[model samples]
Target: MNKTTLRRRTFLQGIASTALTAASYARVRGANDRLVMALVGSGRRGREVMSAFLKTERIELRAICDVYDVQRGRAKEAFKLAPTEIVALEETLQRKDIDAVLIATPDHLHLAHTLATLKAGKHVYLEKPSSHKFEEGSKLIAAVKQSGKVCQTGTQQRSGAHYRRAKEEYFDKGKLGQVIFARAVWHDFPWQRRKIAPQPKPAGLDWERFLGDAPKVAYDWIRYDSWRYFPDYGGGLLADILTHWADVAQWMMNETRPLNAVATGGIYHLNDGRVNYDTVNAILQYQNWNLTFESSVLPIRNERPGVLFQGTEGTLEITRADYVFTPYKGEPTVVKAEGNLEVAHATSFLDAIKNGTKPSADIETGIAACNPVHLAKAAYWHKKRMRFDETATKMLSD
Candidate 1:
């Protein structure tokens, strides 16, 4: 490793040790001492995470911030928070009582929000795809290490019992002998087959704030509500949905980043005038195995939203709900998953905060999961195979 990376690793190690000691001390406290958390960006995913966090008895939602009045109003109605509690991001961060901030903002704003939250001396539960660009993820890693705060990425599958068991029993135990090919797929039809006419920006919506750091554009509700379709706002299907399965593939294969990437797909069906592609098939090569990921907005739901591992002995298919294992010579086995994964992941974040431990999906793990995502996008844009540096810390131009 380079000197800078070595130094950062050493620094993070020291912080982890100190946090572990602090967690032990914190454990002695009473159960009444709950952690205060605030939600920034009360969008769909934000509300989902908040709902999961609400299931955790150890956390109390003290504040909710959003650029849209509708989302803030909905959050207030659901959580029964006072009008004063639904405020702006700056005001939410200023509150000293908030122990942690759950950030579910758009892709373009993730870096800015995360950095501001860290600077405000609050732990962060950042959603997936750590940064808008590949290089920005490194800055986040450094910031997390320097702050020494519990930062959990939203790859909740890491905390799922099924994923843990699969990783431990099948992959780690060498049961999935010589895993050669891993395929991840996420297919859904969340949009209309026809084109959508642009609507006026809704009242009480801060369009400028929502478009912070993104390229300035005329206010359009289609872009605002379904921001994932735009390049400036989101990373299309790859970043939005593929991130989950890519993370799982990386975790199962015990890989941080891919060796190279080549992609070929486009907006073949959904012609909604969206800047980003609707259908994308990307192939990422790793040292030991290869991962092929395909995502689209097609209505066909064949083998929808799951990861498949092909090994010498057998093939294992894993989803958030359960896993199916099939051996070459034996009958296929199915394992049903128990408990709520979202709640478990939220609890892991709270535990990490109270105990000064790293959450199952820590900052580094988030960065690792994002590697192939950013690379695939790059490959699609450049129309050329892309590779990461030897250290897998930086993306190569070629």
Candidate 2:
């Protein structure tokens, strides 16, 4: 057997051994109760995923794991689950009963957490900014293939109805015939980038555990909840917000990868000592599409941030909650509302699990859309136009 296949098989064996032996409690009479899940990394985001799963009725959360003792309780309280609490992320992976894990920890922990989970034979719902670096993302992609696990990337916009319709009208329907230029923008006022003062350490919080795999640093109040402002723990605004915007572009462009990227902006306006940018505008090039994504910490935005996919006929505007299609021929916007993206996202994932079909927003999509975020950040972070360096493309040559 090949190395990739062998790795995946070994991962499955490890996970299958951990199946929930506590008690096989059946679900409510007539729902799709095929797979039970265990949640890993119970952060604020992890709890949210758990809450959604609680409503799903399909995924019985068997365990909730986190390095922080404080986090595990919140998840238990949220799901009212008798989860086998795990101190380390790996222990969570060892559970054979957990068919899947939702990883919502800090970015730096993603690589290790995902690698361990996949190798242990579990499907994964990995949160955005999929990996800490381009190389890490590549590695996770290989692990996914080797494990033969279904991965749902947490780019929830993929399930947005407005986005689907916009893509259908613009790209699929070709209503926006031969469109080329697209600009994605996000404007956030200072109140949005606001910070709180440093605080006394809280008990039950495993500071060292949270710092797993990240560069060593003294506790800073800003780094705990606002970890995205730092590079080692998060990719900053580039991977955080830009990935969502790029997903829209990727959807509208029919899964296009940028040929090159140029980024310009700086950490101006926001007074806090944030290492990431406050305003970033980037230009990304595809074979036939030219796209620009703009972000701001001080723009007076009436709506939350999203992307605008411009086409020859119209532009598709999308937010986390909804989307809009505007015909450029002096026409009004065709607004579309996606009732609950979280619901849709979960339902899609559950459906994939049952049918053994690839999810709409799988890891491949995550890798493709997020690679540009890294490339663009590399461009501006170093203040230079960057080119894609193809050293190792993974087993699938993706």
Candidate 3:
């Protein structure tokens, strides 16, 4: 069969599978019902998010999955989980007891893991930068839609009280009138840089499985430990750091789609074997405003990472902890943040599952947040301006 015919058939098959899966798991959960959760990719980041999820009420982590025995063992000890509770991802998904899956795998494996979780009739709490590349986003969107599952993206700021207040008091209420430009900044510390040392791969670590769809190469400890610094496993600063700030900018401005983007950066410092840039400066154009994100690993300044919006009437700068609004004519106002972001985000996910409502950061919002970052990365890689075609979901050279 031709490509189009094959794709159509595959789409139809997916719809049928989703229908069957939904029918088999069609039990409406009430508010008081306990949620059985499974933690996939139980590495450092995975365990951190899992702990936050556990803070929420009426949820139990029934199973944990990780390719590396060491990481899995760490998770088991940290969470006081039984040996019998550990299982492979496929086995964990097969169990009907799991109501949702928390996925914090490498960027490349997110699409596959999330799709599998959804197909198995379980809700998903996927980490940020949902897809490794822009091309994988459409597939994820389709899978989430067809499965009718509540997929919450891990943009914790979306659930932040300070973020909402900043949006409502400034952008939404015209405190920051006619906002024209916004900037997102993240400065990495020295401790974040991974040490480059030649050593044997740790026993029980599945190097090949960790590679996923990335290029096959000899095991490098630095790459394994600092996968975010490499293009194969992650999108460097753009995908790793910028996604959060850009999401905040878009969320507060109420504009998720960007028209075009251009980026320029290089691996200035940290002369490691990593291919992805260490510093990046990207600009994304929207309908009424422009957004820019800049990140650097070099110890240049001690400013906290945040998003700032400059408007005609005033300017608003916001971070996870608080927000400051400085009017052009009047005195400045400050609002301190409240509550734990991770717990709040997890609670939103649980509430969505129980109430059948959308999450604070749903799949579409997640994809939209990543859209500009992807375009900016592509622009940097290709050394050309990239335009996003929202309807076609394609990035084109400008």
Q: Could you say which candidate leads in lDDT?
A: 3
Which lDDT tens digits does candidate 2 get at residues 147-249?
Answer: 8888999888887787777677557888766778877777765544776787877776677878887888887767876777778788767787788878878
Q: Write one digit per residue (lDDT tens) for candidate 1, span 1-398.
A: 99999999999999999999888777755344878889998887888888888888787787888898888888878776663545467888898988999999999999999999999999999998777788888899999999989899999999999889888888998887899999988887565344667767778898999999888888888888888888897888788777888899888887876889998898887776777887899999988799998878877676537999999999999998899989888899888789998899999998888787879999989887887899999999889998988787666767
Task: State which candidate, 1 or 2, has the greater lDDT.
Answer: 1
TM-score of 1: 0.89
Which is superior by lDDT, 2 or 3?
3
User: On a 0 to 100 scale, what is the lDDT of residue 138 in model 2?
Assistant: 71
Tell me the spans in candidate 2 whose CA falls farther than 4 Å from its real position: 1-34, 79-84, 189-192, 320-322, 328-335, 390-398
**Candidate 1 — which residues are off by over 4 angstroms?**
1-32, 83-87, 191-196, 391-393
- Between candidates 1 and 3, the lDDT winner: 3
State candidate 2's TM-score: 0.84
Q: Quote the positional error of residue 181 for candidate 1 in Å.
A: 0.3
Instruction: Report model 3's TM-score to 2 decimal places.
Output: 0.88
Q: Which portions of model 3 show Cα errors greater than 4 Å? A: 1-32, 83-87, 390-392
